[model samples]
Target: MDHWDEVRMFLAVAEGGTVRAAAEALKVNHATIIRGVGRLEEKLNTKLFEKLATGYRLTDAGSDIVELAGQMATASSQIEARIFGRDQDVSGPLRFTLPISFATDLLMPTLTAFRANYPDIALEILSSGSVVNLGNREADVALRVVVGGASPPENLYGTELCEFHMGFYIARDLACSRSLTPAWLLGANEAVPTDWAPDAGIKMASVPIRFAEMRSQLEAVRAGMGISALPCFLGDADPLLARVPGGPVTHIGDIWLLTHGDTRRTKRVRLLCDDIRSAMQGFAGRLAGRFEGGASEFL
Candidate 1:
């Protein structure tokens, strides 16, 4: 009880069911976990875990502290949220979580400009497909593409940046082939149907190939592997690719610049949100799928 850090480690191991699992979750060495838990056990004078063939099992004493430890964790997060929300300074670490594809393909310019304009703000990007829990202070802000422009979760607040339009794109040269049978290239993480880049209900194509990531899928399309659906901003910018001749546009969703209500009042967070909204304005045409082929209206 005297060592909060040790109790925290014990809670992690208990929740994760193994020392190694807890270590990975906490981003620490398993040996460090062992040491922490061991110290905690000595401090409390009781054994907390019993290792079985399956995994670690909490002993009576460990079970007793689970609820208390969980409460402690929640209280810690609440304190962090309140303090961070009250911070008015324009300079500090600002963690933003967003989709990997957006980060790699469309966000560099906006992020770079934000950094340049706010040199004191430490920008951190957690670019992945997974959503970071803002309520837990895992990230200060999140950029998400949701099904509709309206109705965000109760805890979040933001403006809808733009509607993200997706289009079936094929290599410019390949689309011109008279006898060509286009195959589908899709993201492996997509549902088995991969309807986002569907065959448009008319097909005479070869089997599809799946890539683990969007960049790989984009590269495959660029290499003329087959047709794929991409955000207009990405596909339209590539000179080698074009929307499939007369293909119908797909509305992926509206991009929302969301921050938990707790952090919305923070100066840096609000400033970054404003910058992103302004940047999105410039690319409104591209996001709406109004590509001019070789022209530069989005510039």
Candidate 2:
């Protein structure tokens, strides 16, 4: 294997903590990852990882090497971003990231329009649950939710699309099932105000049904699992879901269409940003939860 490929394999393994995960991330077979890491360890003449039952734990030496490798990756990404930033043409690869739900629920039509207008841009939409660090060139552009009015990273520049809020929601049938005790269906981020359930004017259960992701949480709610704080666009639009009255409408965050400062001027990126901003204006009402909604009988 080439020198950088060896380093890349070792870096992937270190980041993923498991050979299978590294293989999946790199789109290579498990044997390839094992072989590359083995070759790297052989050349370095030291054991980089301690193979544990749980996963590969980095040795002290491995940690040091990983830090250097991370720096190398960052520098390489910066160089690539800078070169791509200077491109003036519309025809080129453009990768962007956003929440999978947001992409499907709110931005699909707008994204379709952008694709229609700029077919040569080679647009790539990355919604996989990955650390989409613009600094690392994981994606060239991003639709990020900056919570609590926080600013985007110093290295990023773009405009705020708008803020979307969440509402307490329950399935219509479940709400009608008066015998069933009320409960919370938690999504990925579990940090929530303790008083939210009480504020809903319902005697909710103390324990929540936890989900690894919001998508499954949404499905659980639809299947009459319990109440959950769902985005207004999602809960309001679903026929089987109904808003629970007497709860605070929590602001998730302002959605921002940002790009690394180095690549902000790239033709395709700028055009796509423009398209999103323009399209967002048309969706301001829906995104901000202007739909006429009926409340579920939660009390």
Candidate 3:
């Protein structure tokens, strides 16, 4: 097999941690990925990954090779962008990674408008909280919400879109009752706050449901399951929900639009960046949660 094809398979397995996932990404069968990895390992005379019950775990050799492979991928992407993507008429598929909540709640409507404005550009949206590797071409651009002090990778160029605040919210009907300790509906892996104890006059009942996705959390809040900290844009806009009184902003994060430094200047990338900036400006007030009392100060 050619070195490029073998190396591509190896890198996919390393990143995906499973042959099945690599197959899906490459649009090939699982056996093909498995064979490719085996052949590559035989050629190198080294065990690339350690098979485990959970999934494939990379060995030291695999990790070392993956870094080199990633560099190669980045270089290839840069060359392609420079050579074939220079046309002023932008037309191609662009992949963007972002948190699911941001995509579904705030960005989806604007993206439809973007498509209307630029009919030639096709969008592929990848939603995840885990950071995507733009350098590896996993995504061309990213919309990230990071904590106030967190820094993005140096290789990324970013435009700050807005700052957003999170606060406790509950169903509007449940807003009037301070006597009852509402059942908590938590985000996935989230622990109920210890401060929500009887001593604090905010004790919670048993939490029966928790969701990893923000949309599910919002639905639970609207159903009066319990109070949760929601982004002000989502909470304020929902007619069925209301901000829980007396809770200050629970979290603050800045939303950033980011692209790899190498691709930032590509014509298509540049055009999309400008489009996103303009769309974000239209939502600046809502993105910053300006509708909530005193929330504008945080923005």
Candidate 4:
């Protein structure tokens, strides 16, 4: 049996979660997929998956195999690229992952220009709230918002993109009708203020509405549900929401461009990173507010 072919079948089954799905993805018959899996299990002398009514489920051993298989696939792709000199065209699949909100509000607008400049490069944007594993090569690049003293993995390389200032924003009507006092806006929790400024002396008459996502928080504020502290890039763009006067200002977070340390020097990786950094720098005013600070530290 061909080991590589068996490995590919294992990966397909692991990804698709069923022999039928794997067969479809591989453009082979289901029997072929089942035989491939059986051959792999016979060679390894261990059951990778358990047959179930719903679908095949990976055993603990299978889970471990999947992780290793993903890494192997990445290495294989890199080897193929090297042999073919695929990087010479600067146009190919560029998979990237970023925070959902950042991708929608910040990056989506400027992606057209990036594509135009490098028409050969096909961009794949994965907007996930969860952190992607760089070591596994889940994504070629990632954009992360980090706080002070945070360190990335030793296998990862990161560059400071920009800093965003945060402040409270409320609907125009809410600002007008309510006292708009910090004390009234902030409820009992001073550690994290809701609609009012954390430092504001006014006490809240009732609990302000809370939202888990930034986009929802912004929407709630727009709907006049309550005030919310948001980054300038997202908040300032909305016409209905206004940055409250005399509001306490805070550091939202620093945006960083990240890639695997080993792949950072790769031609495609470096070019994409440079292009994204340049785009972020150009939009510094709109996204991060006007802050006077050198690129040395988190502003």
Candidate 5:
């Protein structure tokens, strides 16, 4: 039995509390995990865990081992990074995270172009609203929307990508009615379309026809439910949805690219960032309308 592998199994068991959970994390069989733990105990000549009906609990010695194991894991990761970092070619998996809406719209096409340019680089993208932890190695890069100037950790680097443009949109049928003014659109009598708009002021006044996700919100609008405030990308893509003629345009947020300071210097990361920055230049018109004036101030 490999001592390091056994140590890793032991650490996983300690962190996960159950052999079943550890096995799942390690992508190994349950019996394999149990055997690994047994071998680790035999090598150390001490019982590290107390088996229970539900799971396992660490002994006094196990607690000490867990801390050491954590350090070892960190060291191993650092070594692996260093080894990969030495290669001049941009190879290996690059984990990226971004907001779900942005991923589907702004970043997807650009990412496709990047992959075409660098076939050697494997990309793993996680489209989620939840922020990923860079320090913990959860993601190599992240894109976020910030209302104010963002201050990432000193060990991390960030660059402003673009400003997100937003405005009220309604179905062509609703626009034809000529009663879709900002005051009336979200009024008590008017039907509110479910988008990311805040439920205050006009939003509070109206009765929401449906509260839904991005795709559904656009669908609802196309179905002529009501008016909704949406990002420019979504509105521009749909011919059925028309931007309110003269309404309060909002600056939903600024898009930023964030990466660990150490990773920023890497060729793969630098290349990808440069590509994204270059692609975002085409969105100047949309960004300008959102930021050049007090667009988001109404909210």
Candidate 6:
């Protein structure tokens, strides 16, 4: 039995939750995954997984080996990088993760400039909201927004990049033509606590829309669908949108830039981090929502 290949297949199946997903991630056919797992179980003389209608569930024996397999994968990657990774030119794959909104609204617009600056660095962006573990090399760096002033994981080393100020925003014409009411638009998955909205001075009216994403919410607000709380950097920059007067900072969060201790000083990683820091610095005022009145410099 080829232990390496067998363990690789097992790891993929365990991580992916289904043979089909494992096959897709590994770029192999479904049959290959099934056969590989079967051979692995045969070698161990134990049923590693229980086949069920929804998906394969790992048995006790399989569950116990997952951590070991993950360790092997990490070690193997490290060895390969140490031996053949071209460290001279700041050239390699750098996996970066951030919230979907940051990627879409902020980074996407300036990615071309980053690409032009660091042509050798292969940038892989993970936009899922799930936090990937930097300790395990799941990602090289992350830009995360956390509310209520919680600290990031102790294992990671980074700093708060900027204050993410939020404000109630509506279309310029909507504010000019009508009185603000409780027709608040919300992200489909967002939960506006029953008491929180009213406590924050937002009076609820009949809502016309529940959008699935922040970008959609922004568009709906632009089209005069409803008012929504949006990041100052996004809402303030748009000429067509205006902040609701007397609406205090709806939410205040900090944008954290983090990286594992292992890669913090890597040339490429450092360069990318610097670029992000500089970009945020340039928009510090807008991001912090600093203003004398309703829409002074922000508007």
In terms of TM-score, the best-performing candidate is 2
> Which portions of model 5 miss their true places by more than 4 Å?
1-85, 177-205, 210-212, 288-299
Better of 2 and 5 by lDDT: 2
* CA error at residue 67 for candidate 5, angstroms: 39
**Judged by lDDT relative to the true structure, which candidate is superior, 2 or 4?**
2
Tell me each candidate's TM-score: 0.63, 0.65, 0.64, 0.59, 0.57, 0.62
Off by over 4 Å in 4: 1-86, 179-191, 194-205, 291-299
Which candidate order results from sorting by lDDT in descending order? 2, 1, 6, 3, 5, 4
Candidate 5 structure lDDT? 0.70
TM-score of 3: 0.64
Model 4 over residues 24-110: C-alpha lDDT tens digits? 675555777788888899999999999999889999888888988888778877876785464456766788888887778877766
Task: Name the top lDDT candidate.
Answer: 2
Alpha-carbon runs more than 4 Å astray in model 1: 1-86, 148-150, 178-180, 189-203, 294-299
Query: What stretches of model 3 exceed 4 Å from their correct place?
Result: 1-85, 177-181, 194-203, 206-209, 292-299
Q: What total of clashing residue pairs does each candidate reach?
A: 0, 0, 0, 7, 0, 2
Residue-by-residue lDDT tens digits, candidate 6, 77-139: 787578544554677889889888778767775566887888889999899867888899999
Query: Which parts of model 6 have CA positions greater than 4 angstroms off?
Result: 1-88, 179-182, 188-204, 291-299
Write one digit per residue (lDDT tens) for candidate 5, span 181-249: 332233223344434453333333343544435666666767777666667767756667766654556
* Model 3, span 26-99: residue lDDT tens: 54556667878898899999999999987899999998788998887788668776775555567787888988
Lowest lDDT sum, 10 consecutive residues, model 5, at 290-299
User: What is candidate 4's local distance difference test score?
Assistant: 0.70
Q: How well is each residue in 1-299 modelled by candidate 1, as lDDT tens digits?
A: 46877887888999999987986675455776888899999998899999898889999988998899999989877987788766988799999999887787777888998889889999999999887888788998898888744445534565667888977777766655535666788777553334333333335365778887788888888787887777888888888886765455778788888887667778998898888778777778888888676412110
